[model samples]
Target: MNRIACALAASFLFASAAHAQDWRNHQERAQDRHEVRQDKRELRDDRRDVAELEAVLANFDRARSRGKEREMVAVESQLRQLLKQELVEGRAELAQDHAEIRRDNREVRSEQWDSRHGGDRRDLRDDRQDRRDDIRDARVEAASQSARKNIARELSSLMGSRRPRDLQRTRTLIIDLIQLARKEVRDTKQEAREDRRELREDRREARDNRW
Candidate 1:
């Protein structure tokens, strides 16, 4: 009887450890979800910024073409000041991205660890897809952050020396950043659709499992 009791206690300890690990995974998944939402919100704001900046640049181009010297001066001055401020903000944003990327990567690694202990993958397609999405989104966000930093760098260079060639390069960077932001927006929207579909499927699966 004592031998049996020892074995039972050992089993109980193993089960409890498994449960705790699963609970930690659950919390990590929740945190990932919250981060994704936050990223979506930031992307929306970036979309707006891209649009407004594009319009402003377009107006500057039009004014330059028409030889509106006075108007061009005003725009350039404003642009210079804006870029100066952007450099500071961009540095902070890059630091934030660095931290977030590390956190995201850690979560992905944790999820991979959890997968080893997960049950019956055949019925968990949604779960698998969600994990894949998490990984993909992290990569996308990392690229987006890098692009933003590059854009800020270009802006900073132009601000320091607004020569014709520098201006052209800044223009190129602006266009590239705009494209990147748009792509991110589209990707996020696609992910959101997948999330909703997966949620519905997950609900159905949960209900079925309850039986």
Candidate 2:
């Protein structure tokens, strides 16, 4: 009877550990999905920025052609400022993305380590990590929305001063920008798809190990 009771308790413990590991894997998969969505949003924003920049460039060209020296100079200044600001923002965002990826990777490694080491303490660590991830995700979403709003406002302001001649030039520029944006969007989507595939494979491997 004593030996039987010990075996039952051991089985229960094993099942509990397996359940915990499964839950951890599910959370990681969800996080990966969130990241893929975030990348898609960023790709859309990038396309918008490209379109706006093209519009501004078109307007500048039109102004120059019309011999409107003052307007040309003003537009040129705006273009320079916009480019500089965009460069700064782009670099900052790239850095943030890299950091987030690194952090996620660390979390994955830690989870694997804990699974190997096996203890209740790992659960507490996971809970803390989840909270941190939630906060970071919220901040990233807010920043993305803010960026989209700013880009829309700038595009609206630039479009407000459009002259009849500017329309044709703007149309041409828009076509070019659209083509470029479409290609970029396609590339981004492909990359995201590949990322998701790898994630799925990792999850499968994790599940196999759990069993």
Name the best candidate (by TM-score).
1
User: Cα deviation of 99 in candidate 1 (Å)?
Assistant: 5.0
Each prediction's whole-model lDDT (CA):
0.61, 0.60
lDDT of 2: 0.60
What are the runs in model 2 whose C-alpha is more than 4 Å off? 1-9, 107-187, 202-211
Question: What is the number of residue pairs that collide in model 1?
Answer: 0
How would you encode candidate 2's per-residue C-alpha lDDT over 60-118 as one tens digit per residue?
66875796868866765665565456556555655755666565566656566665766
TM-score of model number 2: 0.53
Candidate 1, residue 152: the lDDT equals 68
Clashing residue pair totals per candidate (backbone < 3 A): 0, 0
